[model samples]
Target chain A: MNSAYPHWKKGPGPMNSISIAFASGKGGTGKTSLAANFAKFLSHEKNVLLSDLDVEEPNVSIFFPENEKPGSSYNSKITIPEVDLNKCTYCGKCAQKCNFNAIAVYQDKISIFQELCKGCGRCSNICEAGAINLIESEVGKVNEYSSESLEITEGILNTGNIHTKSLITDVKKYRHRDINIYDCPPGTTCPMVESVLDADFTVLVTEPTPFGLHDLSLAVEVMEKLNKKFGVIINKSGDNDHIIEDYCKKGNYDILEKIPFDRTIAEKCGRGEFYYDDENYRIKMNNIYNHITGKIK
Target chain B: MKKIAFASGKGGAGKTSLSMSFHKYAKDNSLFADCDVDAADAFLLLEKEIQHKKPFYSGLKYKIDENKCIQCGKCADSCNFNAIKKTDKYYIEEFSCEGCSLCEDICKYNAIESRSNCCGELFISDTVFNTKMIYARLIPGEDNSGKLVHEVKKIAHEQVLSAEKEFLVIDCPPGIGCPLMAAISGINLLVIIIECSQSGFKDAVRLINLSKKMKIPYITVINKSGLNPDIDNNIEKYLADNEIFSAGKIPFDKEFVYLLNRKKLIIDSDILSGNLKNIFSQIKNRIEMEK
Candidate 1:
């Protein structure tokens, strides 16, 4: 075990865990790369539970290939209301109560749009005649991958499925360890919010471009609004890093670390290979880990 | 009129940059709509002067009156989202509240009142390039971004019909989720931007799968090519195997990032402009073929 950090379980087991979520408002900003590498680095001493909450396109597991073997997985389901025609009075109460517009009533006929439903059960609960019955519908699957060093739980959303939040919640409920790292989905919407809501700290990753700065600002606003403690990690940092540095300085946000723009790193990430085998990369990850544990502890 | 939307399942995969460049090249014959409400940046490059704007009220959230005599726990127990909390006074966590109004319906004292939230603002503006644009700004941390994207598209579609525009170019949000689905609806074609990285390809494939499932015909563009030859070859193989058409490949260029930092479009760059021209022409040809 690492002498500096407190010792905990050596694998996926229940403990007083501190979760850190790596998120970005813009896509392709190295959230998964940073999250995966950090989790692997931390797992050398303490038990680390890494979760891929980017249900839409989870790529964290791609970096953890175990001799081309598959992980143990199970389907996750959400409840959507189904109207019973016999009990239905066609009064339009359920339709009116649905904020998502998933249900509609017209001229003694009812329509249910399953895709639009959020599975909030409001329509079923509001149905006075007991016509609306909530039914289980599979949205995605939660897969668990384990090795001697680390444990990973990934949420894979079924194609055309929009229930990203429910599936993310299911993945978060799976397991925990000494330290949890969540690779959040891109964008500052519900899915991103759900991913970061329960994290002890959130690391906002970004590049040093205008789009990166803009989206990073939006993500900063979300973290601030949610009252989450967060810092910034500038990936692909180069000469134009002032674009983000100036903004971070103005906002007094902590610049945890920067991963320089290197072609070798990009190639390694493109091939889904770990680039943390070098001493320089290990020091950077250690700095971030120490910074986060120092603050949260 | 042909309406085409550009989307990348991964963020920062150059969807907005490419769409802006396409709109610039297509010139006055096209209109642009920024449907990525969560992180709308089309206006940054388009240089727009807002002509008309309005607050968009998406849904309602129930607020409990502090003076109401009843501090009943029924509302708290009934909320599936666990948004309701009784700490000195009954209150709702605005972030988690879905605005279902079940609490408002059950409260006999009429303590809860449904308040429509101004989740975002919609704008109809004219860009410096003489192109009319429609965009929206969703308040940070607010829900209903998908609904806002739909509203922006609906208006853009109406304007395209009324003004007799030849094309409606849309910039879609990343990820094959609700917002992307909303942006894809009613669009004649989808331009899937694939960043030439393993993560980018994986995400782009997800978006391609979604387009296929929705029966939306699309063309792919592999951006930031030459970053890795292996990834490039793999992407080519996958596209060839699936018989999917690709618009073209864009080499990895630092100039694109500099141009973006300057709030300039690809058409404004001397180096990247030529490649964008070819891509724009190919996409335009595809859209024209649809007619």
Candidate 2:
């Protein structure tokens, strides 16, 4: 079943029916804006589904604020252990059974730290006293924004929660459209791995700086391990660069597009305006979309 | 020792830049730790040779005994991660595998086993400024980065206590997640960096609320402040309404990347040196006030 990776269809599908995830090992390189704007640009000609997997601080929803009439939205909850107070004897059995240390019995009391709970049901299965029960806990909310032909579904994680991967998995459950773009979290960690591993294509975005170059290599290493087809997108490329360009050249990686650093673009971004509406960014993104589609085919 | 952490809920908001600038201008003898282990770029800024090194081990990984596998599908059926693949044989894909060990419990022939691998390596060295620095690199795809961050902080704290360093500067990871929490926990002072972008404002607000909830003494430092007056003003007003102090603002300058490219500190940059000194003074004063 494709429930775990709803956007990903195994093997090759039609040329334009592939899921592409945008990521950068270094954060704040404009992955969310680029993905959001590109999906908007692509939606003009096709059905586009943009999913935000950066649950810790989902920003895609900002581009599509809550509508007055409201699009469909729901909560994504996971199974966490609940203890029946009368049945609980402070036996430490369920606490010992949890592999994540989500439950610990101390001072004849049960303290459950929900952030650490993995919702694997191991504790309830191992509890012999019938004291532990598996109950649903809301880790994040999945909000959907729909227009004439586009749908943007974003997973906003509950603050101070640790189940980032689970929230990403929940967001990926959105109905598959012809083109799906998943905006992944920064850093080469579990969250990034989960977002890009199953996608048909991954677009690596980076700025022209040392920090971007260093982290881009780490992210590239992860894609190599996952055996995914990926390429690099250079953002804010200007003079005082060549760090990333040299690396990409030497590494034999494809350089998709370079969006130069401009004051107008940055200011527009600060005001929550989409760059794709501009003729310049529109032309560039159109080419980028064509390039990704060409490679997929 | 006074523990001060610089964190930006959104990455690339200049946490490393601000920390490096403060370290350059501060007077007190201090220790630094790069708690953003997953993508630790502060190490590159230090340009220091390792004085000591060791392998870090954390979390368990499931390994399949291919030789003993009976070609049955029990392990594949019970795996929670769907990491088991049956290409030629049932092999575990490490990238997707969470190592839950449910497959090991169901295997009839003991074909599955749990083994721990090296999470990454830790390095101990002195920065070009002569301050001791601790940084770590997480083995890609390894989970429990919060634990790695904790180990990095533990080493820095222990070393600072024995050496009597007056302060510890931590370059925290972006986002309000486990690793970020680990970096800020037990801190005497927390410096949150925020930019003027939409996500930056949103994430910074989340971080500020979490800091207040945890009862941590905190201040905000605006990075790339002058680029967009609208978002910047809104963020300043939001922080003010929340009763949080804005330490200072560092203007948006393309030359800020000079130090990152040259591997030098802000003091070396004519473009940034003047304003950086004033911002560093405010941060220093705040740390002393906390003391």
Candidate 3:
């Protein structure tokens, strides 16, 4: 056992369950890699649950084997209104009341687009003619996996589906009560915001480039707007560390750790091989974990 | 006009860099739209000067007047999103409130009022390449990105038609979600940028599936290739097995990142421009073949 890891036990208090989310406004900034590695590192000493909330493009499962997948899986559904045209007075009132434009009432027929519906149930409630019925429609599925000491939950959205935000909410229901880490979707929009909303702290992973800095600033704006406690981690650090370091310094944001731009690590990650087992990466991951727990304290 | 877009399921897969290069190579013949409104970096590389800006108004938000509210908790019970909460007083959480107006309809006290919300702003700008560019920035924490993307596409379509441009190149947001659907709808061609990695290839396949489902013709270009020979070969095998058409591959080069640090496009650089130009020409040929 690594002596560097602090022993964590579940207890009743304000610090009963600590959850942290890793987010990046820019994709491919190593959010998944860093989150997965951190989960593995923390699991060495404490039970950890790593959840992939990037329903649209959930990749956390890629790092784990499928045969070891747990039996807990269920179809995620949303209540979408379907028109029962038999009793229909083709009043356009329900159509007019729907803000998402998911329904359209025409002269002879009405069309209900399931993808546009946010499952608000307003249409069914407002349908005075009793033509609209709220039905459970499958939007995606949630699966849980257990490997070694780490537990994994994945929210996978079906292609052509638009209810990414709702599916993420369903996935969060599986969060472990002791320690949870969420791998968030890229961008500062609703999906990313929803993933990090309940987290006690957030780790913003970014590269050391102009594009990274620009998007990092936007993510910082989101964290600040949400009044969330967060720290920064530079993934592909090189001579360009100052690009992010300077920004973090100016904003008074804490820099947790910097993973250098090593080709070997990239290639290994490309093959679904994680480097947290490496002595150097283990140390870095431990440092980030300690830093977060320090903040919570 | 033909609308061609550069998109990938994974972020930082070199979508913006390649789309910008294609924009430069297309010269004045094409207009550009950066549909990745969440983090629009194309504007930074375009050396753009804003010509016009307009507010993007979308959806409605309800606010409760505490003085009029009797604390009956009907609105809170009726809200589907759990946006209404009682903490000293009942209030609507703007971020969680989807503006479905259910509370307003259920309120008997007239305490709840609805108003249109300004989610973001769109910009029409002139780029250094002497072509028009369309982009927008969605207000953080707002979920109206698909609507914002639609607005960008509408302005771009009008601009392309009015200017008589032959092609419209759009840089789509990552993921196969609503915003991406809005960007690729009715587009003539989708240039899928596939990064040479396990996660990257998996996400790209999803994007390709979405394109096929939408009946939009697409061609793949492998970026960051040669990072791992095994992974690269596997990607090639997948493309071949699926009979997917690929424009070409771009080797992993640090020069591209170096140039981007300087806020310069690879097309303007001497070392990497040759390979990129060749790949982009193949993309152009694919677009022409569609016509």
Highest-scoring model, lDDT: 3
Residue A54 lDDT in model 1? 93
Tens-digit per-residue lDDT, A120-192, candidate 3: 8888878888988878888888888877888888999999999898888778765464789999999999899
Error of 3 at B179 (Å): 0.5
Task: Report the first chain's TM-score for all candidates.
Answer: 0.92, 0.90, 0.93
For model 3, what is the C-alpha lDDT against the true structure? 0.89
lDDT of 1 at A245: 95
TM-score against native, each model: 0.94, 0.93, 0.96
- Listed models, DockQ each: 0.56, 0.59, 0.59
- For candidate 1, the docking band is medium
The best candidate in terms of DockQ: 3
Candidate 1, residue B231: Cα displacement in angstroms equals 1.8
Error of 2 at A75 (Å): 1.4
True contacts kept of each: 0.72, 0.60, 0.78
- Once model 3 is optimally superposed onto the true structure by TM-score, how far is the C-alpha of residue B37 displaced, in angstroms? 0.8
lDDT of 1 at B199: 84
| Full ranking by lDDT | 3, 1, 2
Candidate 2 lDDT score at position A143: 78
Candidate 1 structure quality by residue, lDDT tens digits, B218-268: 999999999889889999999999999998999988888778777877788
Inter-residue clash pairs, candidate 3: none
